[model samples]
Target: MSMFEKPSQAEQELKWAKIWFKQFSHFHKRGGKANWDFSPDDVILFLRSKRDQRMPAWKRMKILKGLLVYRRFEQELPIDPFSFIVEKMKEIVANERAKQDGYDTIEDVVGVIDPTEPDAIQQFRRALRKDGMRLQTERSYVGKVKAFMADRGLRCLADFASVRASDVEAHLTDLAVDGNVAASTQNTAFHGLLKFFTLVLKRDMGPIEAIRASKGKQVPTVMSTREVASVFEGLEGVHLTIAQLLYGCGMRISEAIRLRVKDIDFDNHLIEIHGAKGGKSRLVPLPDELVEPLQRFVESRRALHEHDIANGTASVWLPYALHRKYPSAHREFRWQYLFASHRLSRDPRTGERHRHHIHYETFPRHLKVAVDSAGIDKHVTSHTFRHCFATHLLWSGTDIRTVQELLGHSDVKTTMIYTHVMNRPGVRIVSPLDRLSEATGRQPAGKSYQEGRIAYAAG
Candidate 1:
């Protein structure tokens, strides 16, 4: 449509419904044969199928939001389906909150009923949790299996056992050829499926020749000093603080957000990073410039914690077995997140209402806005700051070993990617082309170029 033109109401409704359905697919996918041209009734049937699947309230809300427009215009139903789903979600949330507030007995906390393949997948998740997989790793593994099952029409654990090694291989091949997924994504899915089969389904996927994704050397994107400054110029407040930590402390966004009150030592000028990538801990030097601001930020966090305590909802998420051992630690000020979220949220896993840390997604959203507003052309993510941190440190003559330690990299080689990203592999040397151009007898050929016709040769 042109700028002056508007699409018909039906056209607009269908467009919006499609967008919502795509969003829904991110978290929920039909696990059986689904018609591509699904009607509103198909959507309703799918929702009804998930009644016992133990979906979080927030996710159900997203589904309802997606389907509301479709149900309103495209179909006539006996009841307002969207409103029903909305009320169901609200009830779940309220029940969860009530339980947290001691209004319900322990019996009120319910586990998955009428267990399906999804419930069986939860068993695998519990095993992963017991083995102490990082949250991101768990999500990736679970998501891959969910996507695979959805694609192959695997409705239950019985279907999982029947899947052959060839099936797994073909699925991965399709991800590369059909989905056009990135090499890393393909690798992740491949490994995730193998793991799900072995660990979750308790079946071996032996000797499969899957068409592997092309593995290319990946170098992290780094911003120049001027470009880095430009990103900061557009950001202020907590966003700026988080970005600064990403660049200054060589911390991942997850580590930075999960930083707790007790982790920072103002007197020692060190920040303790616990439960980082690979479940390792390390200390990084706190930037001299950020100390006072960090102190003030901590004060604000403490205030929030005090308010939460008074409101009887001060719990913060603790790493495995710690919360169980130290039940009161969740409510402690020292255990409070350094960058607490503005509002209290219910933990999807435990259904506990508490003030959690700032979500990992929030920083990236703000950083993208800042980077765009600053007119930086690079694809700057929260991680780009980390790349900048390492590269800048190396450029300023920091030893490789020290940089590795600061970066919480288990191996020095892992930290060595900065050398490639910095475009300074091995000892820095002037290019041969530049050297030749600098010679007295030779000027750069392209300095003054002219288009001239060449003489035609007779064959």
Candidate 2:
């Protein structure tokens, strides 16, 4: 090509091909090869090496594109071995860019497939929703399935058909050995893939024999009554009420936030928690202290609901097909969220304007501020209140089974975790140092321990 003339597409491709070959030559040489001649297996191994080295997706795609152009136009190979690999690389690059742009959903990762085409992710999501999975759980399962597909370079729906139990075992083993992910995370990924294969793909995933991630025992953090009171002093208004509900009712943050007006039974003095973890419902005794304040809060919320109704935006979200079954139920005062968002927003799934609950982060942000103001040293979160609730109840001599029922834990063993942190008076054992001080008839002194012993001896 002349310097004055623009280079043709073929010429530019050849330049990139030269650059790709130079890198390939170095890789081949390191593997004890003496010549430029290479096979498809060699190329595949080279790409795997790059992946193991954590090369950026875009750079990997550029390298694969050069190789593809070289094989098609320069070498004139009868069959292109790199064509499928190049397309898969392009998909990987697209997914990386989408994630960087904060588009994490499976639909966003695999953009706009033809309606007639079989979409594994779309089928997976539909199956999950049909099974009445919670929104958070659905997202988690979808994300895990997407990660499995990305790991095996399965870009299209057809690629999923060829997936075997061995492939799943290898991916799970890699997560344990290479990624060092938590045991719960690995279990979630395993279940997600298992569901995809069995439910969505209608394939039997023969028993998987994969290396499992290591599990560690973690004790829940419990706050003393004094510390809990101090934290409450720093918090006021809606945040304080939410915190109290978490501690007093033994409700999870999600369960507390999703509370509708009808869930609270003032006449019966019970707070009905529906759709808690594991899709179970339970009734917890309403705290005597919260009754008056909650009544006042409810009155304020009623006024807000009326204001929204006057403005033609009093709609709240109803689960499943409730809106279709009871058209006017969403507009009723009893359906309103006890802690509704200040602003009305469009539901991403329905595209309808509704007043959803407050954002999950808002309460935690306020809790953090309160924790700082109260000078609490331990790590604190919204869930800490629930932990405190369980441990404090145990300390106050509540039966473990009763605590389990109130917390909505499915198993008594699951509720036993709080027992490890409870400071029960019946189980108190004196420290050895205190026992020694008692035996010596002298209290242990900070700097005057010897003087205290001498004084005790003289006495």
Candidate 3:
């Protein structure tokens, strides 16, 4: 409103300033001491908006920390008024610093700690995404990092460098000591942090060489052949098909559920698994037995799709918009799932309720029941089938490479773990004492057992 101020500049800045003020006012219309506070840099942006100007990209980012500082510390001015005097907003920061320093007790001091410092959680997420981390990995990183920050009172990304490895060591030790986390479990968590520091934070954590974890004493849980059969037979309907796929295709539950109708190539006898783990896709030979069950499922699937379309419920997946591209693709055979969800599911990426495939969680509930009914006499789960699949394949003289490919393992070393279960291929030697005859120079009752069964089976 100054007379000497450039009319165009003054008009542009003040006009948008008022507009932004109204937005905040509207946001806090039902408010007490409306918490929306803006700092000097925020005011600069409001003025910049008026002149139809944007701050230089680098300078633009710097303003967020200032705004965060304003929101967290200064309660005197609304964001709009602060935006005008953003450059002169240093006093509020100093006051916060003074208050932070004023606390005598550790608990009070911790309370005074600024949570919005540099907002590292947000920054770390962006960094991980840019680094092409998987959605699951990104989620894990967020959970682990958020917990770590909350526990240790981290305010900014820069504070990570100050987070001593010893502190992390103590935490890992505590987890192992209190939670009884095995060495491997502890390593996974510690390595997650190591990845965050070395990869995301770009910190020179020096290979985490000294990070030693307590080793875990664990045993592999393998479902017996009889148990596997029992669980396999006890399953029914889609649940049966699901378990069949688990054993038949040697697939994890996650991989089985992600299957689409298009993934199976009946003519080529190939089943394509896309980016199953570690973002790598591979094709495995389709089990011949699965073809029949899959065909039966498809018959029902086609009907379901038709019914859904007729009832305005089918055709859920919509072939990823292929319905629009090809127009007739919705009714096509390739577009139908071999094992389809009766109803459509929403597209997580698009937020559109279009069916993708059978959900991963559905079959497992029924699988546990089948496990109990089969009378396998062991605590087993769906993953037990996958474990048995690899072991059985190895027992049937399947090559390690073939089994590895079928199991979708990136390394042969992972497949080699199953080798321990199959045992070495060698001749069994009987003790000389077993050759002894009884009474009439013939084998006695107990001694004749192996020969009788061997000869009987031979007959």
Candidate 4:
């Protein structure tokens, strides 16, 4: 490309913008729209509004250079202002990350008080809190109820009275059809709506005659013993120990991450899972293999706790009114998370900065890396270890009832799925073909009944 040859308008614009941004752009600190509105004149107005802000001459000149390109592309301004100011984008990205890092409480992230949410939706959320639902449960139920209310345009408590069974049915149908939501998701949404109508609106959610989403029982993926060993071989340190607990106790990822210092009882070789699924408490055996490693891990956690205490940032989240009842419980070691995060985070509710648990995502991310390095191709995740725990126990001839108790399952039927997933070929009726091979005889295609009697009987 010679200098005489004209470059495309888009290429020319990108080239000019790149030079300006790298040369200049982060000279002043300011906020921009979380998502740009993308109207050219509106963008220009936004830029003009920044003129009154005190910034250096270089920063002003850079803005002028960007403005020329934006005006050239004014008929079709880019949705992202950062694309034209790449160097200026790092500070904005950093600010977003800082916000997330500082956010420690679930109530801040999931329990947002949306001003636009309807009165009935607000009441439903309050009802959920009063009933003492888990933070994750409350978030799910509130979001579903909000979607239902918005679908029916129910703004006030009075508007809820006007809602009918058909409206609810239509919403569920759309969830299955338009949203293509799974059977479990659709069922969860139905339950949330049912609670809202029954408890908050004081009305029965009459029969929903709509076509329901297919609720087929899905067989959970289980790791073979060899696969499980390979996964563990690829992991070490805290991650390895966490994976062991997941497989050893048949604990869910959330249950493991939420473990507090007092949950593990090394003396009795027991682990108490509090507020498990359905708000039930249960005790599971702490594996003899993990006891020593776990004790070491807990000692390390104690060191971290002491460090935080000296820095005056050792508070942990206390459920319900325990903080009110105990007052000092938040600062107690017993309430501190066993798998506490390395970074300190600010609790939006109390403004008390503290260390939360290792982020839930970190385990799966590192687990994936380990799995790849080990060259195991099957789709495995942190939860796969839990599945392996239950399935392996069943294969080892452990009583179904005992496995159910250890897994904190409410029904033996829920625990029964592991039986179906276990590698139990001999338990199943042997096929005649296999029996024929074992009997030192082959199936003769033209043989009469008498000729195959021995093979048939053996089978």
Each prediction's whole-model lDDT (CA): 0.73, 0.80, 0.62, 0.73
The 10 consecutive residues of candidate 3 with the worst lDDT sum are 105-114
lDDT of 2 by residue, 1-459 (tens): 221124586688789877786788687775433334456676778788888999887887777777666666666664355556655665677566555544554344332222552387877866664444666887898899989988999877789778898899899999999999998898899888877875677655877778888887889888889999999999999899999999999999999999998988899999988888877889999998899888887898899999998998899988744665678999999988999899999865556799998999989999999999999999999999999999998898899999999998888999999989634667776879978898998866763778888899999
Model 4 ranges with Cα > 4 A deviation: 1-118, 153-161, 346-352, 425-459
Candidates 2 and 3 compared by lDDT, better number: 2
The lDDT leader among the candidates is 2
Off by over 4 Å in 3: 1-119, 155-161, 198-200, 206-211, 215-219, 306-350, 422-459
Give the Å error, residue 132, model 1.
Answer: 3.5
lDDT of 3 by residue, 1-459 (tens): 322124586445445444445544444452423455534544454545533563342333334334434344344444444432433333333333334444333222121223453567665655554344555776676676676676688867777878876667666666667767666666666666766775456553442223344664444467767767778788888888788888877887877876777888889999898757776788888889889888787677677776767766444445223444466665555666666665667643235555567766778778878877876666677777788788888877889999988887888988887866644335344545655553348666775798889999999
Q: What is the TM-score of each candidate against the true structure?
A: 0.69, 0.69, 0.58, 0.66
Worst 10 residues of 2 by lDDT: 105-114
Local lDDT at 45 for model 2? 80
Q: Which candidate, 1 or 4, would have the higher TM-score against the true structure? A: 1
Clashes of each: 0, 0, 7, 0
For model 2, how big is the CA root-mean-square deviation?
18.9
* Superposition-based RMSD of candidate 1 using all C-alpha atoms, in angstroms: 19.6
- The TM-score of predicted model 2 comes to 0.69
